[model samples]
Target: MWELRHRGGGGPGPGGEAASPPREGEAAGGDHETESTSDKETDIDDRYGDLDSRTDSDIPEIPPSLDRTPEILKKALSGLSSRWKNWWIRGILTLTMISLFFLIIYMGSFMLMLLVLSIQVKCFHEIITIGYRVYHSYDLPWFRTLSWYFLLCVNYFFYGETVADYFATFVQREEQLQFLIRYHRFISFALYLAGFCMFVLSLVKKHYRLQFYMFAWTHVTLLITVTQSHLVIQNLFEGMIWFLVPISSVICNDITAYIFGFFFGRTPLIKLSPKKTWEGFIGGFFSTVIFGFIAAYVLSKYQYFVCPVEYRSDVNSFVTECEPSELFQLQSYSLPPFLKAVLRRETVSMYPFQIHSIALSTFASLIGPFGGFFASGFKRAFKIKDFANTIPGHGGIMDRFDCQYLMATFVHVYITSFIRGPNPSKVLQQLLVLQPEQQLNIYKTLKTHLTEKGILQPTLKV
Candidate 1:
């Protein structure tokens, strides 16, 4: 069996000579030479024993907390087999979670942002815990503290950008916030620099490689969890529909695929996810596309879902009331000849947003599964069944959000590339933050351009 070599304090350095006592070391040093060489010499099979041969059956069962169901429910399900029992438990939990999700949605955008932030924190914790386990034998100083510090720094930066973008009026009301907003990037960088210095200071001789590995692991985790979650919030700001459609599409795909695979699966879809099958993939694609279309059509009719979330200074709360954009308005489309002949209609009225949902759904079905596969490969690399037992049926917050993050990124890109343009409201908000003279100068320039274009009377009074 493969075994990990544990090193004592003052272990041998590159040339296998007993090294001197530990001391603070440079962040970039020659220590990696020995570490890399040793890693190359180690047998891969020994390093991750049984990972190569482990099958789907190795997944762990439900914990005691989950297994102890209500007596009434237990009695109701007692006649079923173990498989059905598990299905019932998972189904019940899934419904409960969905109910909570709807409540969050009803509470409005701010609550949704809080939910994203909470999930980001949990996902970060789960991934960092794995890193801690891998290096628990080493007495790395200040590693955990610095990892969390970096997370705070990153969140500060991203959320600061969000505030500056969305809550301009609110920030303008506060003197302290104005200064912070003016130099937010610089402050964020300084905070990160402090954490970086702390990391370098915590590095010890003979543990340089492990310390660096942990550092990289912390950063990659932040990239996957924090950055992607930030994108999700940004999508929400675009309009709740932009956020809801993509997320719902992924959920629809996941559930429909599972249902289809559970009943009709025979051909394997991929080795990474053994349970995924061709039947599921195809069913999920069609189901998700149809769901996205209907979801978009329904959400588009409601200003609450289709309007961009904006702060209302008068009301002192965020509001989503605005003239519905062209994307949300019903537009006429000419049907193809074959379709017109079959349906006996020449034209169809639909919201433009519904058309965009097809693209979102297609990507969710095709590319989104790869995100779960990537997570699966990550688990297999560490020879673990799940990230954590945070959820009863689900593995961890990270596991539930793996595909969602990927979908979030694609939605953000799609909005920026296809849906969004220079926002007059955002520009007005930026101008509101400027000095009177600067604002006046821009006003005069815009007036001049308008006059030159014959769109405004040059002599009109302000």
Candidate 2:
């Protein structure tokens, strides 16, 4: 029993030198060895203790710093909180940015010029980045790089200063504008061809099917975006109905959807996008319709200033003393008979308030939400969460502008066909009652002038 006590005491046996407390260093080393042995024994005991009588407290205490449970949990919660805070901040910033962007864009023609060019370029870059991420995820390295460069070129050339100058010049004359549109078609065809070539060259081995689908999807999306943009520009819808209606409708829809979704959303609108709710859909629809009516009423009240103004010069052939600059001045002008007739017409007339407002409102609401749904479908198919995290609450450019693309297209078409009536140029030609020969002469004269000015080239079929 004494020998057993000496062994359990963790000291030398009795026959050896008398046991003494170790030096400081030796004592630490001894304690370490003992602790290590204790740890092993504890582990073994733990393995058997489940079937025995040992309790948790029997296990030796480790250093407080080594107790990782609270530390791990704290770290996890800190990271999550930080992410939440960042998203919150981002949401606020995005709201400000969007509000400012819309205000600047809707102010006037000059503002439209700056906003459209700059924002579209930024949007193109964002699109290219999204494409790169998508392609890279599938390990298509070639497409990842090729798409980036191609989009860069598109933003630089097609959407750059050259196109702006072309558009500005084209709009200066009706005949030149028609010619410019025809020219633009050729450029568009070239871009399509280039896009197809890049898609083909970026193909991966087993991903051929995916590549095909992606190509087709991209083409459709690009066509939609381009067509919408063209329609908006051609209508000169820079500030009035074109700009105001779509922007207001989209905002109303978004706000209504969020409010309803936050408060009353329960039933999922679609399984793919779990957050979207039926309540939100209904609320957004109603809101959009209400906003549309308000827009129409306001626009109709301000319709006089919305009409395009034309000026004509009247020259006195008998007077040879007129200065060249004086000849070009407004004082030398007489309002054309057409202009005089328009001036005589009643001004600032409001449309009769009718159910048309409700129809317009409902149409805007339905179509805009459909755009959002379509974008959601695309994201789900591609296995992407968001286009980007740029907007905080908004997601990305695609997210914010998705509904606008479709809404603008529908609004432009609707206004042109119903509210605006026949094309202005066609109506003017019809009203003038020119003979075929006279019309031909006018066309030839305009074409000749434009050709001589180098605005229309010999290669142009028109």
Candidate 3:
């Protein structure tokens, strides 16, 4: 009994000696072998007791619990307690960043594309780092190198497609770029295959499970970071308006949700984000819709906002000078019965695109918040504070823009499915890339079809 007490309760003697104090009741003449074995057992326990017990200190610095600061402190800080002060500081900084972003975008679309690529790379870094820190315990081989190689391959595949799709005219004209552009997919696949072979070669017989786990992790991270951001750049090519409006709408919604939640939030919305409230959700939706409408109406007047983006080779720049599509043009619509009765107007004229803001804003407020919730769940799953403390108060760039990426994707899909039509310029650019004989065949077919429709005239002496 005294031996057990000595081995468990007593840890170490003074002067860094690995000695457990013998209890007063124990005999001094115990076996040397037993004493040494007991001492070693005690030493092992002392080293790892806290980790084994899963102490509070071992938990994530920022926990899964809701932001639940005391009422007294909140009142003391004038309701700016529990991260609100941090929120204001970050918010101001964010607005400044947005202003600078627009200034860069004003310079050229190329600059904006560079900004997006930089952000994509940074976000990928934050996520991949988290996975490495979490799963590196598996002792997987070539994990970091393989992840980076996959990122390179994916970026090459995506950006190459973008250049080919949007800048085909410039590509076909360049002798050096034609081969690369024509076989971009094959090149991307070949690069990926090389990486795949390397990963297989690095796999150990005993570590196959760990190797496969890291592989899936790398691929999933790529999907989340790369695919969504690609859609965002695609939205930019449609016109800066599509990109700006949806992103701004999400920002507006997030701000209003926090404002409303702070003042009027009572009923919790979700367990994942316990501070969220139904009041905040509804209030933000209404506010976002109003903001989207006003913003869309004001921007439609500017060619820079309403015009489709087109490359102007003659001017050696990108330009937004196309005639407003019917979507941007004003059209008559019947009002609701109540509005019609109150205003005594049978019909009202409004920019048709302004009405579309309702859908965009609706998604921004409703479905977009789920993206944030999804991110919250991901952080919680990893037992992490933030992906990285990229922004002091808010968290990482991922934390701030989780919903914005979702909104951008939705906007792109909405425009393509419902609003976008085939572009004559793009069609002509593709035709220009074909052989002369092939071009002649298309021309003959078009001429015959147009003549059959009485839209083309036969040659006649003037």
Off by over 4 Å in 3: 1-80, 137-139, 422-426
Worst 10 residues of 3 by lDDT: 48-57
Ranked by lDDT from best down, the candidates are: 1, 3, 2
Report the Cα lDDT for residue 41, model 1. Answer: 43
User: Distance (Å) between predicted and true CA of 28, model 1?
Assistant: 31
Alpha-carbon local distance difference test for all models: 0.84, 0.55, 0.79
Regions of model 1 farther than 4 Å from truth: 1-79, 423-426, 429-435, 460-462
Candidate 2 colliding pairs, count: 1
Clash pairs for candidate 3: none
lDDT of 1: 0.84
Estimate, for each residue in 1-462, the C-alpha lDDT of model 2 and write its tens digit: 344223323566598866764433455646767766655564554443332232444333321212222344445446456546444454455578768866764464445545554545455555655554544435654554554445444444344333333234333345654444436557656765786687777776555644554455444444655556555554443224455556667877877787787678998987766878999989888777777776666654443214331222233111112222211222323456787688874333334432345655676677677777888876665456666655544666777777777766776776666655655543443423457788788779979999899999865566
The digit string of per-residue lDDT tens for model 1 on 197-283 reads 988988776566677878999999999999999999999988999889999899889889988988899999999889899999999
* Ranking 1 against 3 by lDDT, winner: 1
Model 1 poorest 10 in a row by lDDT: 1-10
Best by TM-score: 1
Candidate 2 minimal-lDDT segment of 10 residues: 316-325
Error of 2 at 450 (Å): 28
